[model samples]
Target: MLSSFFTISLKPVTRPIFLYLLLLAVCTGGTTGELKAADNKALAADRKKVDSLNQLAFDQKRFDVAQALNNLFNAENLAIAGNYQKGLATTLFYEAGIYHQNGYDKKALATYYKSKLIFESLKDTLNMAIVNKEIATSLYASGQSGEAIQLYDESLTVFTKLKDQRQIANINNSLGLVQLDQRKYDIAEASFNKALALSIEIRHQYGEKKAYYNLGLLEEKRNNFARSEEYYLKSLAIDRLMNDKFGAALNHLQLASIHQQQGRSDASITDAKEAYSSAYVVSAYNLMKNASARVIDVYRQKNDILRASEWQDSLVNVLNMQIANEKEYALNFIEVIKNQNAKNTNAEKDLEKQKQVQKEQLLIITVGTFILIIVAVLAVLALVNYQRQRFFGKELKQKNEIIEKNSASLDQLNKEISHQNLLLEEDNKTKNKLLSIISHDLRTPLVNTKGVLNLVNQGMVPPEEADRLLQLLETQYLGTTSLLDNLLFWIKGQMDGKEDDKVKVGLHQLIKVLEEEHRMPLMKKKITLRNLVDRDLAIVTEKEMMRIVCRNLISNAVKFTNENGTIDITSRLGDDHCLYLAVKDNGIGMTKEAIEKVNAKQYYNTTGTSYEKGSGFGLMLCRDLISKAGGELIVESEPGKGSTFTIRMPLS
Candidate 1:
């Protein structure tokens, strides 16, 4: 009989012949006497083969999963060939167990159902109950806890009737976890206590450890920190005795979390480190990740940045290991699925190929007929398209001639329209400028004159103060007259569409004239105005335009100058052969935006430091005059520092 078993030569033979002989003897001893007929002997031998393979698979699964699965699949094939229904169901159950252990819950659930159906057909109640428990466990893992609880109850009832204390205790633990998840705390506690009492009664150390760990979780959830620690310590002691590093790691992590909840950070860190070490020893990547993260978090909460950074690196390494493990597990699962279904897949592919061959033959004949029809249609279309192209060609030539003639007329019209638009834009600008000046600047002098006359006529002014006020009024009136002259020149130049008259003007004389023009405001503000230009510094520019630019710049300086501030008008001939006339003032200066607006010749309004009023059109008009004179106006300013307004003009 042992020779017969060896002659079959089952693959993936990790164990010796003696091991198979031992399993065969244990499995077939009762059936050896019942083998009377030849068919009966063959059936018994097939059943023995399946049982031996299943036993071998179970033994191999601990260290070599692929080899284990291969053994189980071989067993499955043997059982199906022999019509050994019980053995086939058992093989499927083992396969599903493997899937569940490897974290393939959906596959596990599917395989479990297949096993359950077989067991039901055979009326194997105990095996069916076992399958139902596995299915429930898989469902719980997949987050279908409601369905899982119902199935668990059915399985628990069956096991209780069979007096299987081990299964009863396991089911109670599983039920407690579901209840705990649903937050039915008291119900969960009762279930966990039952599991604990039964596990202890049976002297099942592993079951007791699991029960203690679960109770620790329950107490932790209820915020009973001391009690949770007690249960976790009990679990830890059992884990140590069993030399289960994985279980020890989980218990330490739970203890660490409980310590953290109670604000015992130091104790929490110690426990977390212990957990990390234990998990590392077992190569438990997820547990190591959790332990490291807990340590990093506690260090961060303590405001220990250095310690946090150090542990964060460790956490990253652990996370990488976890990810790698997950990837490897996924790849192995795919391989397992392919290996399990390879025979069925091959049969289906063969059938599909035959169907595809018939489809292709019919398609080839249809496409050949369709291609002839398409060629006939294309020939007719080509003739029609060629005739249409000839007709359209003559029509396109006529349209092209007409378009050319129209395009010339359009071009002339566009040019005239553009020129008229430019003239209109210039006229609009001149109108806006004149209005701004009249309404804001010119009105001020007239209003001041009226107020002075009214006060004098009423005899409200004292004689001594009246003379000074009248002098101030006379100076204002003269300044207004000068502004009017400049405005008139500007308007005339715009109307004539010509540049202003330019001539060589002494820079020194120009500044001296401006000094006299702004004398009253200068005296009123007590600002010292200096004329630093060399008398020989002269350039050919429109004298009136230069005067207008210089006058406005000086007036602005006087208006903004604080009491006792200074104004300096200087000229220097640059190496670029340009006259740089600058009116620098130690007065309240412009912001960068204000200076940009001035340089860009944009019209804007702002009151001076002395609250002096203006049209805000001075800078625009001065820039226009300077540009027309073939020069550039440059402004530099800093808030509270001062400003320099420079006119750059070519000597030629």
Candidate 2:
């Protein structure tokens, strides 16, 4: 009589408590041979029947499997006396599957995770892998391809270890589908090929059909029409052999699509019709509608208005049928939902009762625990503050001592820095005085020597001896002049505190005058002068200072150029209306070392090409004058190549 009661209670409940009662009853059953056999067979068959019903419910889009499984799970709990581990795991799996089919992926994922934890606790690796694969499928369907691939890989590893080739092939096929979604064509193709080979080896017809279908889709994506057609046909053959009418219809539809892309309109029409016929046989409303639409397009393109219109009407009818089917599915879904809601309502009430009981117990415990914790916290706080105050006092004393020592040291350092600054100022004043004296005294001798040489060259002395004397005097005069000019300008720049007097001057005219003045000297060296200047170019600068800069640059160019060497002077208007002047000379250029020294902020001297001595003050004067004029002096030179000096000044 207890066995009878247990069997009756195992009829599936809508509440959770019955789950525990069922397990207790099953364990308490002291049954011998017949009762045990009957119970085992009934349990196995019961699960199988539920699974079959669930699949049907899903296919028909009922979406009530959650409520159904909850009821079954409750009954199983009662039957197993709350130890319905296997039944609960299976129910959760089916419930998640239902949510997945109904497009409630988030709910499905949560349920799958719940089921996963239970399976893991039970150490059921096989069902765990299956649940993982289903979860991956759900993820892939929801456009989470990357995550799906990782899950599929993990599932495949387990299946491979179990030596379950058929299951591995299924995982491979799923992985291929995800790869296809990700546009990873090569990997997709390899995965499909692996699945196909394994399926063929095991003669797993469903796996082979799926693999071929995936390969066809991949080929179609790649625009390999011929290969796509071949795979579609292979998949169609397998579907036909297995009597899978839906698969057959899908295959024909895909082939028609390929045919249309290949411009085979008649073949496309024929294939599309075949797809419609197959779809009709299977009552696949969506596929029939798609095939009819394709036929209408094909006929319209072929200029068969009558046939196109007929197919168009057929497409409309199929669309209406599809809508009706969807509405019917929606109605059934609503009914199933109403049933689920009724079950959930009852469950909620029971859960509320349990929660109220738990809340009352928890509140009492929490109040007592809170009182104890507050007292402990107050005790800890007083001890922590006392220790912190002791540590802070020690820190304060150390900081005070360090502050006093630093203050004394800083005062002494300040006094030493002040003394050093005074010495540096005095040294700078002495250097300035010396530079001024050297500049003035040197200029006096150079001017006197130049005047004497000029008289000798003008026949105030014997002509034969005059040439040698004049050359020697000219060399010495140039050296002294350059030294005095650079020294005076550098010293003045260091000491002068007045604004430079600026005026607008035609740059081209100034350059022309310099070129003419240097022409005689340049000709003596056999240097050819090429002037490329815009006559309209003008700049604002100090006239006297600019003249000195121009004279120095031209003189240096003339001195450096070898016999028959070319010297080009170019002037142009630059960006921001700046006048840029460049003097280029093909000469015995200075080495990198000499160029570096010449550019330094120190006195650097060198000899001219005519064995003439130079104080290197020419470039220094040029640099200072250009700076005072708000211009830049740039030089480019190499050891063997020529040099170019560019002066950039703002145009007026």
For each candidate, what TM-score against the reference?
A: 0.47, 0.45
Candidate 1 residues 1-652, lDDT tens each?
8555544443224245446556756665545555446668898999999999999999887656777888898898778767799999999999988988887778788889999999999998888988898888888888999899999999999999999998889999999999999999999999989999999999888889999999999999888889999999999999999999999999999999988888899999999999999999878888999999999889988999999999999898888888987788677767876876895466457657867997997697567656644554455456658978888998999999999999999999999999999989977986887887888689989998999988988889999878988987887786688678777766766665666566888889988988987778788788999899998878887787788888988888887889999999898889999989999998888898988787777776787777876667677888888887778988888989999999898899
Expressed as tens digits, the lDDT of each residue in 1-652 for candidate 2 is 9567545554443234355545544654644466778867887766665555444434543334345544544443332333456666776777687667666789889989988998999999988999999999988888788788888988998999999999999999999888888789999999999999999999999999999999999999999989999999999999999988889999999999999988999899999999999998867898999999999888888899999999888988888888897788667556765666686677667667877987997686567556544544355456658888889999999999999999999999999999999989966965775566577647667677777778876778788777767665664555465556656655676675855678887877888887776665676678888878777766777776777787788888888877888988898777777777899998878787777766663445666677645555678668766776778888789766789999988765
Note each model's CA RMSD in angstroms: 20.8, 19.4
Model 2, position 481, has a per-residue lDDT of 58
The backbone clash count of each candidate, in order, is 0, 17
**How does model 1 score by TM-score?**
0.47
> Which candidate number has the best lDDT?
1
Colliding residue pairs in candidate 1: none
lDDT of 1: 0.85
lDDT of prediction 2 = 0.78
Worst 10 residues of 2 by lDDT: 73-82
